[model samples]
Target: MGIRLCIGSVNPSKVRGVVSAFQSYFPVSDVRAVKVETGLPPQPIGLDVIVRGAELRARLAMSGDCDFSTGVEAGFYRFGSTYFDVEAAYVVSRELGESLGFSPSFPVPPWFVDEILSGRFRELEEIVDSLYKTENIGEKTGFISLLTRHVVVRSELSRLATLMALTKILNRELYEKGALR
Candidate 1:
């Protein structure tokens, strides 16, 4: 029997990222994409909340049939006076337990953060879409693509986060030995 993987979201960028990341380390045979609620605000703030959202998604996506489940969430984290956008990935498996990873964060524009804080916009995508005149940018190239001129797309962020999360699973012995504890 081959490995079966389930991703918590059906978003194209997230699904692509998780699938690509998993395929890099495992010979995945079956992949399923399901829509799961994060039970978080549209734009979650803080690293803890973002990780929690990912954990929730991962746990909710788990089923009896799949060998593994993953959740990917993107949000903002504040550092000093600046807010940076970061993506978090959480993976869960019966054998490996669970692990969390994050992608490199990039500072978001202060004005954008202000808008989010003002309750004028609940999600960064809303502001970006309105400014860029694009629709559902999150499902496509993503705001990161726009900021980086397509050098770093959303899927890449998700993929990197997932890879980082899988590190613990890949080196299970090291982790078990308290290398990361």
Candidate 2:
């Protein structure tokens, strides 16, 4: 058996993205997934906030019986007049470097702010669900869902990028320790 990995999320799309990203560095046998709660306010507004959120999930994932655990948290922050969303990823393992934090933020469409702050979306997932019509956020967006079709959602990609960054950090740690022969 290889390193048992766990992700602190039940979202399959997220799991697929993160698993794919890490697979490039480690074999599938070494990775795994698990679900954990992330206590974060809606549209987290800064790196520190989101990092804390990621850490919370990571710690929860690591608490389980696994070799390693990963936590990914995504949220939006405002810079000047523009708003950007970022994903923060955390990897935890007893054998690995205690902890590492990285944030990957990208600018999103402006109109999203109004729709987001309208009290209709309490979390990033809610926004995505509303947009995709896959998971409704209380049916608050009657015709708005149609408009979402025109809007592009980059949140998932940003989250995946954060996961990739974390994987890079972990791989480097493994290589330095001769764990990645």
Candidate 3:
């Protein structure tokens, strides 16, 4: 059977990044994505809240009998005077004999904190989409878009960082189960 993995979100940018990430593993079948509640509060922060949010969606996606599932939650964590926000993903595989639980991974770059504090990219995905034009969605394409264009493109970084975290999760899970080459 093909990799029939399901994404826990229906956001277009998320769908594109995740599908691109998993394409190498499961190219034949499409990356099936379903809309599910992340259970995250209006303003999510802290590692516990983020992990819980991801777990909620991961379990929901897995319950649908998918071979694998991916869930992403973006939030900001404050460390003393600085605040760092990033998109994190939790990947789960159903092939494990027992519940392998969930793997948490994310990209933490120096500028990520500045962007969050600068209030440019309140929502990382939206900022990135504005820069990359990945989805061509006109929700934030107006003249009043409030995201920083300094440093790398926000959308590319956000999506690339998220994809990297997912890739790491996939590699870690596969290696732990001796499925990795």
On TM-score, the candidate that comes out on top is 1
lDDT of 3 by residue, 1-181 (tens): 5667777776665556556656645653746777797656643667677666655665677755577776765566657655555555666766532122222223434464456447766654445556666553322221112234333332343245445655555556665756655
Model 2 C-alpha lDDT per residue in residues 1-181, reported as the tens digit of each score: 5557777776565565567666656665754556666656757767788788777877887754576677776667789999776667777766655454454455666777777778765665566566665563222321222435625333344345545556546666564756666
Clashing pairs in 3: 128-155
Q: Which residue runs does candidate 3 get wrong by more than 4 Å? A: 96-181
Q: How much lDDT does candidate 1 score?
A: 0.93
Q: Which of the two, 2 or 3, has more lDDT?
A: 2
**Sort order, lDDT high to low:** 1, 2, 3
- Overall local distance difference test of candidate 3: 0.54
TM-score between model 1 and native: 0.96
TM-score of each: 0.96, 0.69, 0.60
Q: Which stretches of candidate 1 lie over 4 Å from their true place?
A: 178-181
- CA lDDT scores, all candidates in order: 0.93, 0.61, 0.54
Who is ahead in TM-score, 2 or 3? Answer: 2
Tens digit of per-residue lDDT, candidate 1, span 1-181: 5689999999999999999999998999999998998779999999999999999989899999989999999999999999999999999988987899999899999999999999999999999999999999998989999999989999999999999999999888887767676
